[model samples]
Target chain A: MNFIRMKYTKWFNISKDGLSKNNPIMIAVLGICSALAITNQVENALAMGAGVTFVIVGSSAVISIIRNFIPARLRMVTYMVVISSFVILVQMFLEAYFPFIFAALGPYLGLIITNCIVMGRAEAFASKNPIRYTLVDGLANGLGYTYVLVLISIVREALAFGTILNIRVMPEAWTDWVVMAIAPGGFFVLGAIIWIFRELTNNYENA
Target chain B: MKDYLKMVIFVLILGVTTATVLTGMDALTRERIEENQLIVLQDAILEASGITDYDDTISTFEANLEVIEAEGKTFYIDGEGRVSYTFEGLGVWGPIFGVITLEADFETIAWITVIDQEETPGLGGVVEERTYLDNYVGTSMYPELRVSRTADADDINEVDAIAGGTRTSERFEAMLNEAYQAHRDVWLTLQESAGDA
Candidate 1:
């Protein structure tokens, strides 16, 4: 039990456990808003995933670096300041460069700051961990979240347009399923994935 | 006291370093991003104008292009290299804006580009879909574009209006007509300016 109390050892163990396909979105059902909103197209999902991953890694590093200076009462503000600065930088860069995507993904990028997945990772993992391990944990979780998003977007885009990444994969005669492009379609696909993953991993946790 | 001061300094240094790195990346990528956006916008305009895969040089596109303004919206003309017809319309929601580059006779729609709209997705979003917008490509502009019932196959301008989006279709028609009128008005102004020139 004391081995679990070791700082670096605990950070690695918890990060792996948390991101192990059985945790959060797949297992505990968290942070599904952007997963629903941005998964309509693979390009949108990739942009969102890359943005979130950057913010999570940066914020985690900043929080870990400042763990000592942040008083208990102002810890939340400190974490938010770190997360938001990264979020704004991402937003400004996207706006200045990718105007079309910036238009489409406008408010959702800002909403990443409020995403519990990011805050949760900061408070639960980064707060106590060393800087090096915290960055790894943040990267793992971000990649895990991205993996789910790409998977969901793949199904939605293919079925909706009869293609992957907008390249026509289906024959001309194939009638496209128009329903797949609507927002609700993402929810149905996400739920099915979560169910399948849970069923597959349920045995290991139980036994 | 010294430990507290050191902690503050450490936090400040980390924050400053992060900002510098992010700003540096922004500076490097800003130009490429703008270039990509201009390409997409130009492509959208070209598609609406019924021109595709033209040489990417701006001068060629600009030479064949004309601008018309009326009723608060602006339009670009394909002009068939001359003053042809104009494509103007309001969108299903917001401003249904597009450029209808026409042949010199002003009777046929050479290409139509929907520049902006706030129409409902899955319904008005069809404006961007090839199935819908492409229909406007070769439509006749003689009696005006009409949104008749789905069963009305009597005329080419009589496109079947969107089923549930009746008001949107009506607004689209009105806007289309407004765009045409605006184009006509602007075309007259352009003539006046040219006559003086």
Candidate 2:
């Protein structure tokens, strides 16, 4: 009974919505561009996830702190500044500390500022909610996007490279599924994942 | 009137705050990023000269290779007269940075290594792969180098292009040729000076 009642709390609902009811990728279909671009390797997925997670949470908290004072005329511009500031910081940090991943991510690292999910959270939840709630919301949504990317990349990498995290798991004789290493492979895996996820969650759109 | 004043103030404060934060962070990381870039170029130069085994790439590069600066470009020369220099070229997506090492003749490719590139992954990204770069070894670069999907790799000036990354391959071919041309005069100058000494 206590656990059931816990679900009614504001934090719980916010987290649940971000993680499941309104998942950035599967349900809302936001940020699919990056999801497909970087999901060929699990390591890239993890690094990108961490980067995105930090930005979302950081930006959301900042927006929530100044939500009441944002000028109506310049609200969107303000969000862009904050979001891009975080993105540039991530780019520089990665370039300095993790040059290999920095080179691998290439232009996509800078594209995080334009990711719809980051802008969406800033517009929707963070702009109206308190900092405390926005923090949890940001974390949940970031992880939600991350886990899906990782799951997709696992399948893609294994089939494409005959390895998981570069560790060989398949028989040596197995020829790589070359298609699975490219954008079309991301499309196929992502489409199927969205389908399975929706069916399991009983989410159906009325046409 | 109050709304206008408040809006201006808010925008100014936000701009200043973001700029300050970014500037501060840049100050912290700028040196490290530059250092890492130098290390990468050095490592590629070392690899091109066939010095692959080492404890520290930077220290090994400093100790083993002699740096010769002339004609506005830097060159790394090993004991065997192999010469390595950095090359810059544009690819399909963005700039490609690499190191090209030449045998004593300054015509035959000793080795090639891409230090950085921004090509599409799994396609044009193959430019960075060892298998692809290996094709350049023993190929001649004088009078221009050709990356052909059809031309024979064994031909003196011909090397294989990246399959499915035709545009990138074409761009890479142009880039290598351009770099060789830019460096050719300096390479000859250095050779004359060495002979005079």
Candidate 3:
């Protein structure tokens, strides 16, 4: 009973760390390129978040399973192969089942293999941890990344088009801010997000 | 020698595993992906011809569409006498695909729908907007459609370009003109053939 309780606590802490303290997008500052690029629309942001989450969890599990066999010198290359395999799977599934989202995502979907969060988790946590812990870590980190992306997308889509998920949320009188729909807009939103998160956490060392 | 051999074996195994997994997934999704592409193309054709009720687009298309093969190109003649064809052209980032429909006279654009594009989101990507595409409708193909900055222009062939997507708009105009010129002769011949038949 004590062992099971300890295990549960460990899992909870791992998830907690991922959601807040060691958040991939906020504290770690990984995978910012995609977070910026795809957040212009809420739908795109959600699709991206789901894609990244799938890639991270899938890659982490594989990496953890193969950690014992992977030679130290050839580890990075092996990780790349594993990561890309999962990315390709995700791409094919999206193209087949969700063609509109697939088309909207375009090259950003392929860029998931290079997303720092996936590789970072594989290196920092998965390679050393057991499979169960690694899976939990991956899921936690993915959720963390997803929440931040969704938050940024809400801000961007609302300001830029006066809409969310392509639906008109703002009144007709509200003028669209064209700048907020572009790349520079992503910078301001992401910067503000990092600032707010850091303030709330009161962990200024990384900031 | 032992370390080198180990590295080679490890890499070989990894490569083989990756290939096998990808191949299995490709086989599983190939049919569905192809079907999706066909649906998208069909939707583009119907939308270009101004058919908005897409719940039965495929059946409607089959019932009304007359496919003409001319000069190794496919031209679709709709029930309303408009002729449509897909156009591929270079955009800022990647290839842009559009379906353009011509009036029965074959001299004016009846409608246009940008089926696919890989332009910068919110900027060049405005090319896919309905407003931008609607500008092409009713434009004359004689001088070919040209994108101009000034809105409410008098020229029948001139349309307004997206403010921030100048390069993509320019490329789109050039692509349309080139495609129209390339298929003009074939289209005329097909129209004549239909008239005779």
Most TM-score-accurate candidate: 2
What's the TM-score of every candidate structure? 0.67, 0.86, 0.82
lDDT of candidate 1 over B1-197, digit per residue (tens): 87677657656775786688777877877777767655655566665555676777365557666656655555566644433333445564566655455555565666655655677877876665567766665676665888775786458677677766777778877777666766666666766787999
Q: What overall lDDT goes with each candidate model?
A: 0.73, 0.92, 0.89
Q: How well is candidate 3 docked (DockQ)?
A: 0.76
- Count clashing residue pairs in model 2: 0
- From the highest TM-score down, the ranking of the candidates is 2, 3, 1
Off by over 4 Å in 3: A1-8, A158-180, A183-185, B91-93, B118-178, B181-185, B188-197
What TM-score does chain B get in every candidate?
A: 0.60, 0.94, 0.90
Model 2 misplaced stretches (Cα beyond 4 Å): B89-94, B117-136, B139-197
Please give the range of 10 consecutive residues that has the lowest summed lDDT in model 3 chain A.
Answer: A1-10
Docking class of 1: incorrect
Better of 1 and 2 by lDDT: 2
Please compute DockQ, using alpha carbons, for every candidate against the native two-chain complex.
0.21, 0.82, 0.76
Residue B109, model 3: lDDT of 90
Residue-wise C-alpha lDDT for candidate 2, range B122-193, written one tens digit per residue: 999999999989989999998889887895676789988888999999999998888888888988887888
TM-score, model 3 to reference? 0.82
